[model samples]
Target: MMLLLTQQAYADDWGCQVMLCMSNPAGPMAVAECVPPMQRLYDAMSRKGFQWPTCDLAGKPDTPKPFKLDARPQVPGNLAPQTTGQ
Candidate 1:
């Protein structure tokens, strides 16, 4: 029981690290420390069929929510009629 909890905690921490490394503007490969975590992520995703991990530490939601979009365009005016040059 205790070992399970410990493993869960470790996975959470690793997930958080992976999330941060991925979000880096320079990209994951640029970070020397991110290589192993990235490889682990790839292996887990490719072989174990695991979903991308979320970071609770980074305030990530368990499931992604779709953003709401306006049904209509914001601009009210239509474009002027096109004129061809002689």
Candidate 2:
């Protein structure tokens, strides 16, 4: 769908911008300035695929905890070496 494509494009652009901004000494301070625009982008993206929850997982009236990413290790490399011919 067009909406999904648009969302993906916007996300990619935002990610690039964030990465560029965070690659400097002033990166930490720059985050505050980026928040508003990022928030607006998120709002627009959410509107495209917004869905109301049937039940509150937190049990609170209006609190939601979204998923996040964490660093993880990659698969280990093979120890054996290959020969020229089998």
Candidate 3:
């Protein structure tokens, strides 16, 4: 039973991926960076429970250079106020 539980824990591990665009010596470039299986992060922010294939960003990723990162609150998918609808 313990072995099965351990395996289930490992299966729940999630990846942290980010895209960074920067000014390389050659030119502007974008690269994907992943800091995976952030166990401590998982512990702190798993209040709503584990969500697969997605993360609630605690802090925005850094923009390397030559690219501007827009600081704005994203519109919640279905939470937006409807302009029209009886």
Candidate 4:
């Protein structure tokens, strides 16, 4: 019998910001800003036999709730549309 394993790496825009902070821990650390999307990616990777090491946040985790991207626009009706052609 043979055991197969896979690895998947993903970094979001927010995660990138955290990585820029050289002061952070040097091991696997989860940045709350990217948790939502990262979780989804992690789940998919797990299904394929990949493993993600646990991450510890120095203080409070920055995980933000997922928001719908396709929801209705919130532009106020009072705002006048700008004309491209004058």
Q: In TM-score terms, which candidate is top?
A: 1
How well is each residue in 1-86 modelled by candidate 1, as lDDT tens digits?
A: 35543333365577777876887779985798788888888888887557877766564476565356656535547854444782
Which residue window of length 10 is worst by lDDT in model 3?
15-24
Assess every candidate by TM-score. 0.51, 0.24, 0.16, 0.22
lDDT of 2: 0.48
Q: For model 1, where is the 10-residue window of minimal lDDT?
A: 1-10
What digit string (tens of lDDT, one per residue) describes model 2 on residues 7-76? Answer: 3334435544444444446643367756654565457657867533223224355755534555443446
Per-residue C-alpha lDDT of model 3 across residues 51-74, encoded as one tens digit per residue: 444423424566333346655556
Q: What is the full ranking by TM-score, best candidate first? A: 1, 2, 4, 3
Question: In lDDT terms, which candidate is top?
Answer: 1
Candidate 4 collision pairs: none
**Deviation in Å, model 2, residue 57 alpha carbon:** 43
Candidate 1 vs. true structure, TM-score: 0.51
**lDDT digits (tens) for residues 12-82 of candidate 4:** 34333333332345422345544555455456676867554333332345854334465545568787556
RMSD of 3: 18.1
Question: How many clashing residue pairs are found in candidate 3?
Answer: 0
| Candidate closer to the true structure by lDDT (higher is better), 2 or 3 | 2
| Candidate 4 Cα errors over 4 Å, as ranges | 1-30, 49-86
Candidate 3 overall lDDT versus native: 0.38
Put the candidates in lDDT order, highest first.
1, 2, 4, 3
Candidate with better lDDT, 1 vs 4: 1
Candidate 2 backbone collisions, by pair: none
lDDT of candidates 1 onward, in order = 0.70, 0.48, 0.38, 0.47
